[model samples]
Target chain A: MSSEPRIFDPDEHDDVHLETELPEAELSDEAWETAALPDDLLLLGDQLRCDATRLHESHRADRLQHELLRPERAQRAETLVPARGISAWLPLLWLLPVVLITAALVSNGQPTVPRIPASPAVAVTPSVTPQAEYSPQVYSVSLPAETPSQHGPSAAELDALLDLMQNETASVAVSL
Target chain B: MKICGLDVEKLTSLYFDRIHRAALLMSGNAWDADDLAQEVFLIVANDPTKFEGRSSHYTYLYGILLNLERRLRRKRRMHQEKTEKLAQRQDGPTAAVAADVPVVSEEWKRSLWSVAAELPDGQRQAIVLRFGEELPYQEIADILGCPLGTVKSRIFHGLGTLRKLVAESPGQLREIPRELGDAQSDVI
Candidate 1:
């Protein structure tokens, strides 16, 4: 009932105001001692202390990579089991507008560059430039056709096909 | 590669576990804690200028970490809000999603740390730094960028809240009240 500043009396100390007069150094000590937590809180503290380490052991770089890459792993997991119903294609959903716009643009006008009439003085010839640099490198390799599987062409047919392929490649190179 | 005059790998190695531990205590999930820890370092690695030698590297990283924890908790709360029945939505697919997280006990999920995690960020950080990390109150004050008295008060109230929560629940504490979760968000 008194509004006056009360004097510190050790004898009248209750748990609530137990540390009001204590120094900062003794506040935690005095408070924790008197306001002692139950065994459960102590147990929790012990578990935390044991678990909360300040420094980790020397981890192998790869091991660190493995741990550090957990977010990537989560992303990969999300990717692995992509959204089943409609969500799976959510990423590609944006492409819908893109495709629609592309189609619209294509249909609106050809997607080709606008052809400019050549100046007569420039003499733009129709002769090939022999684009060896841009020609596709055709590697000659044996195909499954050489082995006559039930579903495969015979070796003779394969040789004919190879010859035809060579002819086509040469023609394509010459065209380039 | 070095940032803020410390090697990135060396920085990662030095405080990685400690940050993870602090984060784990703050977030009651290993997966989230691991992510938060990685993010703290990522931010440091990305922007070294944030560390202007004003505070120790640990404290600077901790400040970044706490900011991230706030953001993460906000995101989770949003997700939790969306999942309204987050309590009933335990185990199963969540476990599958957290496949790489170290196996933590379900019992721990319902422990004091879980409830402590629900404490206002200030109190939770104070409690974790004080009791979990066993740092001196002065150091906690430094890490939290608050007065020593504020740090002490936070830890004290944090523990008191923990006690009240335990007493109210009377068993493995689960169902955290929204009021309790929002009771304190600052270093009051």
Candidate 2:
């Protein structure tokens, strides 16, 4: 039952010959590092190296045991769940409305075309009172027989002033 | 545990650290890396014949891990697209504490690793096998199924992209390389 893979031999392969033919194709770790980079890139390279170093320092086959023991079907069942939550209920969801409508129709008797109620008749009413005949009366204007003539004061009407003027005796006393 | 002469349990005990670290590197999330690593072993355990006596054990394991990671990456991408509008963005590989590096360097490291996660499959494989796992050029070539020189070339280009990306955008969520990101979507 020892079906071990035959360890590859460089002598058996022509690739070893090709390796020498194309020296430019290969890059060693030292050569890779020695290749020039910008200052920023150099810093970043060291940082990546630190990251790789951390990865290198530790190891574990944490999931191998579980992966070996676990059934592939069970794993697929977990991920390939075509339906969940709403999807599981989707068919029933699609059928629900039809079921409800059918049940209501059965309980309520044969399905009937609901009649359209006649639109209410609009009533018309005549105004009761007639508009009164509005007639304007003719207006007449009359002049008084004699609008009393406005009269200025005569010498006789101004008796005391006329007497003072006729006598001229009281010129000092009567300042007309 | 011991399927044929594979000795999967012993293999797990042997290279668990290396594979796990590579997974973590490929996926910047510890949880995702763990899942990816375990899936690699599970896949091997299921089909021991898939791994013949062709390459190093680590190479075989890494090849599986890479395939699984790529598949997972594509799956995550498609899932993101499908649920992109679900009021919440799909959760991505977020290794807030992937390494116990200094807090100051965490953002830069996270950014660098995240960008590395987006490299093309071959280049990413070469880079991870080289820098992430600290594997030699020959070993990387074996794991990547490429010539040593091709492995080197991939590493050169991959590191160039990483260096440029880290230089340009070190502490931000870098954009996925459109040209190369989806190139290996069908690899797995």
Candidate 3:
């Protein structure tokens, strides 16, 4: 296929005009000289550009090196992890003691409670024992009837005892 | 400061003409031309990615320069317009043709460059590729990412306009008046 574009004259329909104008001055020596430019201005920019590119690439390499070699937060993150297999089991270890205690308590509850043992005492000899006939020299001395006697604590007395105990105890004990 | 793939010192020795010509073609002012070329180097040095291997290194660099010129033009238009207004105000009443005109030698070149600058972007690009770089039409089209006909039109129109501008300037064969010299005159 041809790549050239078709040229259409639009002047027929659009009433457009096409004019080819020519330069008035024949090329003068001075004009030619003026048109020719200093070769340095052209290349200076590109040369500097090349130097700049080298510098940039050097800096970029340095930056990449820095990025790759620099210490990262990930290193500290690794440090945050416990060392060895022991570290892996640390949580389960803490839970083991609690589990043992709970299991022991639970197992203990499954068994019946042991009965309390009765007191054991050996028989003693009755020699030199006083008989009821000796009257046991029994004498009753009564506390003064009119005077108030200290006896088993009264309901009011017992209440006062408990009130004092309650006062002395910490709030924590009461809450419990 | 640096352009990758191009050796700065070596390019300074070898390719400065090419870079300067490209700049001149893009920017009509010589001073601006040099500055633009320098700026292109800086761009290439700073970010070589802009030159992505779509064309020859020089062509890619040329593209960068042209784009930069456009951006600079947009940025400075308002400021330049204002400055021109101010300058006109300052110099208008006193402006006079010198009795002894000096250096008519470069008048043609300066006028030609000015006319080239006034060419539309597409046409100017076509001329730059065709004449400045001497690129073939297909390569020009490829570089411009345009149809072949468009490139042809650009070259034709660009040359036509430059010819008209030169023909119309003072001390010319044609009756090229100020009105005809105005930038808005349609493509013919």
TM-score of chain B of each: 0.76, 0.73, 0.67
The reply for model 3, stretches above 4 Å from the true place, is A1-176, B1-14, B25-29, B84-111, B172-188
Local accuracy of candidate 1 as per-residue lDDT tens digits, A129-155: 876678687999876656644756767
Q: What is the interface RMSD of candidate 2, in Å?
A: 9.6
Best by DockQ: 2
- lDDT by residue for model 3 (A53-153), tens: 34334434655887886677557767997555556667788899899998889778884566688979979886795555654667889876696777787
Clashing pairs in 2: A5-B53, A6-B53, A25-B152, A25-B153, A26-B152
**Top candidate when judged by lDDT against the true structure:** 1
Q: Model 1 misses residue B129 by how many Å?
A: 1.0
Residues B24-112 of candidate 3: C-alpha lDDT, one tens digit per residue? 55554456666887887776666655555657666676676668877766666655566566657778532232321212223323334
DockQ-better candidate, 2 vs 3: 2
| DockQ of prediction 3 | 0.01
Over 4 Å off in model 2, which ranges?
A1-20, A24-47, A55-176, B1-6, B85-111, B170-188
Candidate order by decreasing lDDT? 1, 2, 3
User: What range of 10 consecutive residues in model 3 chain A has the weakest lDDT sum?
Assistant: A15-24
Model 2 error, position B163 (Å):
2.0
Docking class of 1: incorrect
Model 2 docking grade: incorrect
Measured with C-alpha atoms, the lDDT of residue A135 in candidate 1 is 69
